[model samples]
Target: MTDQLSQLKQLTTVVADTGDFASIAQYQPEDATTNPSLILKTIEQSQYQHLATEALQFAASTLANGTQAQRIALAADKLAVLIGHQLMQQVPGYVSTEVDARLSFNSMATIEKAHQLLDLYQQQGADTSRVLIKVAATWEGIQAARVLEQQGIRCNLTLIFSFAQARASAEASAFLISPFVGRILDWYKKQQPDADFSGAQDPGVQFVRKVYQYFKQHRYPTIVMGASFRNTEEIRQLAGCDRLTISPNLLAELADSHQPVIRQLHADVPFIEVPGALTEAEFRWQMLEDPMATDKLLEGIRQFAADQQKLEELLKAV
Candidate 1:
């Protein structure tokens, strides 16, 4: 019998979710994702100080003729692009570099910022084809992604929690969608004390599975990546998903044990019945109906926005 990792790979593509180089070498995931939070966390660690120093040096060199804010923005872009380039050396798949979360609500601003990030990567002789520019899954964000996709810039719609957001992204023909599994579980655990966790039934797991089945069933070409995991069980439950971007800690956990991992998602499986495109009014209504999704989406955006501000400040201090 095949090991669980191999067995799981038979059904889904596993991507690492971190900025730590050491973790990427250990699990050897096909791709990697980084955001302000992950980058901030990595900067605090003793092992990742070199990454920060390199970013600072690059920022200092390039921004020698620019303003402080411009230098900071340039630094953030350089750091993120540098990290992407380094990770690509290890993972054959694409690396997702997120846009400033502060621009999530502004469609035009997000588009311009994305182009700027892509431009920096291209300057480094990196293939833009291997890059997935990440954006929040707000309506504005999706609109920006649609524009970017038309310009041959693939996008990873992040901070997604609701089915409405997923549907909008698919309708826009986004390159990929990242539905946060752990965050969904966090919401459910707070509200539903009697939640069951048997046989692919957790709320977070169920959310990703539903989106996956919908996309597969309807032949929506958008890729669904289950991200932000809380436990190996959630990861195991989503084994057959289109892709699962896991944290290094969980990847290490998965690699250490020899357990039976079953296939939960597959292209050949029949998809469950799902509804069609929701209207703006319907989307708003559904979001209102589901308090958890509403609250979580807002909270996630706020957190990312705060992190973006802090990153800007860090660049200033550098």
Candidate 2:
């Protein structure tokens, strides 16, 4: 068998889930994605400082002189587009640039920020199809995506854990939803250290599989992109998914190994509809009741928001 990376690509659309352009270019993933956390990771290195510098300069030049908060907001928007623009050069398909996680619960704010990010991408001479404005899978976020989709803006809903989030995203006509695998496993392992979650038995894998089946069964066009994977087994379990976005480290592992990775999840008969799409109350109640989903969702948002603040701090220092 050729390297697992190449073989897997035959069954699925492999996306590089990183902000590092060099690694993405080397792997040649079909698409590339970046969140506030990932973009902050890339900007930490001195070699990537120029991208930040460029964004700050762009912000200072284009944005009106405003309060410190306003300046930070402008700078963060620029940084997201700066990274996405660069990633677009490397990947042949779309580049996902996330909205500020701080606005995850604010539908109007999320829509506004998505436009700002998309505007920056367009200003860089890139088409709309080349970009995915990533938002959280909150009802507000999905609602924001619904409005954006009507206006021709595509969205990738992140931090999606439950099928409620998945169904709402699909109903919102989201372009994609990144169901986090590693983070799910992290939550399960912390809660149940004795449980065996290896391979197909993993909660994260099972969630993605069910969501994928639900989408394919119902003929929903929303794409399932399994993300935040922990190991090769998780990736292998989701081999035939619509897409799998792996980190550079995992991409390298797949590239180096010649494992004859076989497809696992397939479009079987779609299960019966779980229920109607979630209303805001239902969504909130479900999230509140599901401990793992609620905790991971909250944790992911806080971590991303923290990274956004750190990115702003970096802008201030430089």
Residue 235's C-alpha lDDT in candidate 1? 86
Candidate 1 runs further than 4 Å off: 1-3, 269-277
TM-scores for candidates 1 onward, in order: 0.92, 0.96
Q: Which regions of candidate 2 deviate over 4 angstroms?
A: 268-275
lDDT of 1 by residue, 1-318 (tens): 655566667678989899888888987888899998888777667776676677777777977888777777778778788888888888999999999887888999999998888888888889889999999988888989999999999999998889989999998889999999989888888887787755477788999988888899888889999999888899888888889998988877777777888777677656556556667687778778978888988898889778877777766664
Question: lDDT per residue, candidate 2, 197-290, as tens digits?
Answer: 9988999999999899889888888999999999988999999999999999999999999979998888767456545766889878888888
Model 2 TM-score (2 dp): 0.96
Error of 1 at 153 (Å): 0.9
TM-score, cand. 1 vs. native: 0.92
Q: Which candidate is the best by lDDT?
A: 2
Q: Cα miss at 95, model 2 (Å)?
A: 0.6
Clashing pairs for predicted structure model 2, backbone only:
none
lDDT score at residue 281, model 2, on the 0-100 scale: 90
The lowest-lDDT stretch of 10 consecutive residues in candidate 2 is: 268-277
